[model samples]
Target: MAISLGLFSSLLSPRETSTLTFTKPSPSSSALRMVRTVTSSTVSHSGPSKIRGIMKPRKVSPEMAALVGAHEISRTQVLKLIWAYIKDNNLQDPEDKRTINCDEKLKKVFQGKDRVGMLEVARLISPHFLKSES
Candidate 1:
């Protein structure tokens, strides 16, 4: 009879190595038992899964200079910066919170529109970003 065993370790250096031995049961022994062991030198560190999407930074246009300036930035970061600007400037409509009143700089980004809705802000901001050539 033959038994197969598998082992895995994530440590760079282990001061002591633990050995595992498997023994065959005697004919007289009727009860069945199993033992499993895991040895490690350090605790593993794992964080949350990363967001999935194209995370490359895109070029910012002149209209978006007030928010992200001319430097390249990710779409998610651009949205966050825009929202921060809106909140800081108190541009969101009081009656219709979904609507945002455009300031001078935002007016250019919004295509001269005096006001725009939250859902449509991304669409308006899209044109201001271009794929940066490597």
Candidate 2:
């Protein structure tokens, strides 16, 4: 009988595996690179920051008046009440979770926005609040 050495030799060979290697950069160089990256990012973001619109309460129109009633409240509150009404009446879209199916009242508040995401609720509703008397 011939002894088989193939299996033994295979076991002796190193198994194939993947490895990730990272080289440590000098402390000063690493710090400089980090500073440069941060500076560039900030500069890029600065333009959008200037374009931001002021968050002032806008005058409530007749349509908005009916939805929120005759009262002054923060835009956040208006959105909360609107969501509450939607929940109570089951106006949420069945097919898409993010879409809101507006009833008559919500349709007015949403300004004909047939489908709205949860995130845009606050932004879209902000225009409905009564602007402060100045």
Candidate 3:
């Protein structure tokens, strides 16, 4: 039987090389023998990645920004910040973990609702993300 593995580490800046080993099991014992080694590097991107779609940061409304502390943020990031706030303040209901109890800060963002389901959070924040012409 043969086992194939594809990195070795002699780190150099952003580039690294690792020994790619190909092994065959020895008949006499349970251990395998390394037959070959080849070094490879991690690919470096030519430029910074583009953030698009829901991940693209956009201007938010005053109420939204107050809670998130950022004038511009992606939908993904907004959700993360909101959840972090919830956890930090222990906003989730004891009876139901999926439900969030609204404090004054959350109330502004959640349209003055006292309670919000986890699924409702994503939809609720949609209006807060202002449309950008670009």
lDDT by residue (tens digit), candidate 3, 6-121: 43343444354445465666677777566544343467789999988999999999999999999999999999999999999999999999999999999999999999999999
- Model number with the top lDDT: 3
- lDDT (C-alpha) at residue 22 in model 2: 36
**Candidate 1: tens digits of C-alpha lDDT, residues 77-105:** 88888998899999999999999999987
Q: Between prediction 1 and prediction 2, which has the larger TM-score?
A: 1
The C-alpha lDDT values of all candidates are 0.74, 0.60, 0.85
* Candidate 2 Cα errors over 4 Å, as ranges: 1-59
By TM-score, how accurate is candidate 3? 0.69
* TM-score of each model, in listed order: 0.58, 0.50, 0.69
Residue 41's lDDT within candidate 3 is 49
List candidate 1 stretches off by more than 4 Å: 1-54
At residue 66, candidate 1 shows an lDDT of: 64
Q: How many backbone clashes does candidate 1 have?
A: 0
